[model samples]
Target: MILAVVGGKGGVGKSTVAFGVAAELDAVCVDADLGMADLPERRGPDLHDVLAGRAAAVEAVDESGPVDLLPCGRTLAGARASDPRALRAALSAVEAEYGRVVVDCPAGLGRDSGAALAAADACLLVTTAERAAVADALRTRELARALDAGLVGVVVDFAEETGPLRGRFGAPATALPESEAVRRATRHGLPVGEVAPESVVAERLEEVAALVQRSTRSV
Candidate 1:
């Protein structure tokens, strides 16, 4: 299964959620945010190199973390040189070998984000409980439909209240409470489960992972 983890807005913990889902599922997480990558950096070829025709997609795989990663470059030059259309081929290679690939897509409906959505079998929308963010997620949902991708579910990160959002999206939404463990895990380049195995955040993410798994199985 190839899943694209996307957010309606930046700074909503989309990448963090993506990494956690991938780690829990033991899938490869690819930083598809070529221009503003938030994943941990490694000293080697990345998604930018793959898109720029400088490196093979499989060759860019970095297994030095809890979950395997295909990180993106943070430099402006790297992002500028990347070909958005090349992402299809890049994703194909990883999906072929890994069986499961979760792409941490950039925010908005831009070409780069579209490319990742187009290549995904399904997508998990990430957003906050705020009205504007949920509205933004609806736009992303439309884009995913345009690309003929299925919607796995929605993940409401740092959610303190979930009442108003129930039945708002056509798909189910999981609310993950704000937790300090998420911060520590991200800072240390680890999954939330590793940092806080007994935390509510981790348990909620496990439910999200199960939701994704069920979606894949149904397909």
Candidate 2:
């Protein structure tokens, strides 16, 4: 299944959550954010090359990592040259090879982000505890529905419990408390599960991974 891990607001731990879930599921984490790409870097053709017709999707995959990643080029020119419409075919090739594909979507419900959602079988919305963040998540949830993507649920990052997020968007929620492990792992461009296997944040991410897997079976 292709699962899009999205956020309405930036700085909500969206990419980190995407990396963690992909690591737990042994899935390919595609950095779909062409402009603001945030996954670990690799020295090769990346998502930019794929979208720009310079490389095949499979050939761009970097396997030597805490997890497999279809890294995106961090260049304004590359992002401008990329065609959002090409993402569908690229993602299709990935889904063909990997049993599970997790897309680290860019913030907002823009054309690029929508393309990611449209290519997914299911989605996992990411947000923080702020009201504005939750509001953005609601918008993201609506976008997922409009695209007919199955939403696994919402994940409230940097929180101890579900708090007031339960049933907010008509979906189940899993809250991950603020952890130094998450900050540290992300700071070093590593998966939290690998860096802090025993931390509470890693445990919650594993639970979220299980939830994403269940989304596949339910469909």
- Would you estimate the TM-scores of all the predictions? 0.97, 0.98
lDDT of 1: 0.91
Q: Candidate 1's residue-wise lDDT over 1-219, tens digit each? A: 889999878989998899999988999999999889998888789999999999999999999878899999988999999999999999999989888999999999999999999999999999998888888989999999999888888888888656678677788888888899999998998889989989988888888999899889854
> What are the Cα lDDT values of the candidates?
0.91, 0.91
Model 1 bad stretches (over 4 Å)? none
- The TM-score of candidate 2 is 0.98
* Poorly placed runs, candidate 2 (over 4 Å): none
Residue 138, candidate 2: Cα error in Å is 0.3
Candidate number with greatest lDDT: 2
The CA lDDT at 205 in model 1 is: 84
